[model samples]
Target: MKLYEFERAPNPRRVRFFIAEKGIDLASIERIQIDIGGGENRAAEFRQMNPMGTVPVLELDDGTALSETMAICRYFEGNHPEPALLGQSVIEQATIEMWNRRMEFNLLLPVAMAFRHTTGHFSDRENVFPDYGSDCGQSAQRMFDFLNDHLADNDYIAGRQFSVADITAVVSIDFARVIKMRLDPDKHARLIDWHERISARPAASV
Candidate 1:
């Protein structure tokens, strides 16, 4: 499988983390990096693979291109069931899915909005709304507080197990930093501790 991605992007990094946690040697998979900032992702050749023009597309050997981070992840999870990140039991799966959505909606989406609207990094492709972006930054900060409280007792995002929800939370929290969102050691003690634990994992570096 060949993963078309921009490694620095949070979405691609999420998949990389999942692959590493699954005990897969990341180097074994062929990686094709698309220069997102240079409009490479929007070009005709790339758009043919993923109409949405997003990175982190996994192309199968048979020429099937799987887009979306979670979709790509689900494919791998199905293939490699051991040390399951998406979960095995029904309840575990539902719980992980719930937490993952929460992280994406409350943290990841807001952070991306904040960056796009405030910095105009993709202004060439999309409209910039500074006021709305500022609001999104404030909204994302509330999620930081929410996670801090929720993680006070839980070892992972989906409870005691390190699942895909944990991966989402970590990536969202890290990306939030781009909008100047910081999990202060004193203010977000529990969240900070959780971040440190998650970051220490070998998969986190991937």
Candidate 2:
């Protein structure tokens, strides 16, 4: 198996976290670096695997390339159900997806837009222009407030058990700090505490 990854990207980090949590052997898995801003992923060679030219693509032993962070996460869940990252029951799976989607739209999307628009990280791509810097930033801040309130009662984003939803949310929250947006420790103690617990996980350092 092979993984096309980018060190500075959150999407790849999510996959790495899952692999670490699963105790998957990194030595057996080949890693190919994808230059996020250099059009390396968009090149003809890489595009044969992922038309979208995104990072964290998993190439199976059968020469199948899997894309999308959520889809890849689910694939790993199905293959390795011992840790059950996606969730064990139907309701648990649904809850995980629900929270994951919310986090992606409310937090991840905005963070990416802010980075791209403000920094012009991918200005060369015709479809990568910046138009949502202010909107994305505002929406992301609103999400922080919503998450802060929701996390007051729960230890994790989806529920009692740690699931892929927490993985997605944690990555987005951590990435937000790069844009000077984060859960205020004074204002959101519960959320801050939750993050601390998640951060302390042995897999996090991966």
Candidate 3:
């Protein structure tokens, strides 16, 4: 399989993190970098592969192309279940899914929206609303407060074991830097600790 991705994009980074955590062979899957900022993804040849015109599309050898970060990660997780990032059991899977979704909606989406709207990064292709972006920044702050408190008692997002939820949380928090939203050292002590711990992992660098 070959992955069409933007090197610095958060969505693609999540996939890279998942692959690294699973101990997947990097050489086995070819990585093709797409220049998203340059509008390479909007090109006709690329759009034919994925009409959505998004990066991080996994093109299988059989000519099947899979979009969406989680779907691609789920594919590999099914193929390599050794170090289960999603989970090992049904309940664990559900819990991880719950936490991952929470991070996706509450943290990731807000940060991304804030970045896109406030920075006018895609003004050429879409509308930019400063007020909406500010609201999203505030929304991300609220989620940060929730996660900081959640991490106080729980060792991980879903509990003790590290899972995809943690990956999502870490990536979202890191991405928030672009929006000037960050965890306060005093107010978000637990989250800061968690961030440091997770960042030390080898997979986090991916």
The best-first sequence of candidates by TM-score reads: 1, 3, 2
lDDT tens per residue, model 3, 29-70? 899999888899999999999899998999999999999999
Q: Which stretches of candidate 2 lie over 4 Å from their true place?
A: 127-131
The estimated TM-scores of all candidates read 0.98, 0.94, 0.97
lDDT of 1: 0.92
The true-versus-predicted C-alpha distance at residue 30 of model 3, in Å, is 1.4
Candidate 1 on 25-61: residue-level lDDT in tens? Answer: 9999999999999999999999999999998999999
Output the worst ten-in-a-row residue range by lDDT, candidate 3: 174-183
Q: lDDT for every model?
A: 0.92, 0.83, 0.92
Candidate 2 lDDT, 91-143, residue by residue in tens = 88788888878888878898878877766666777555455776788888888
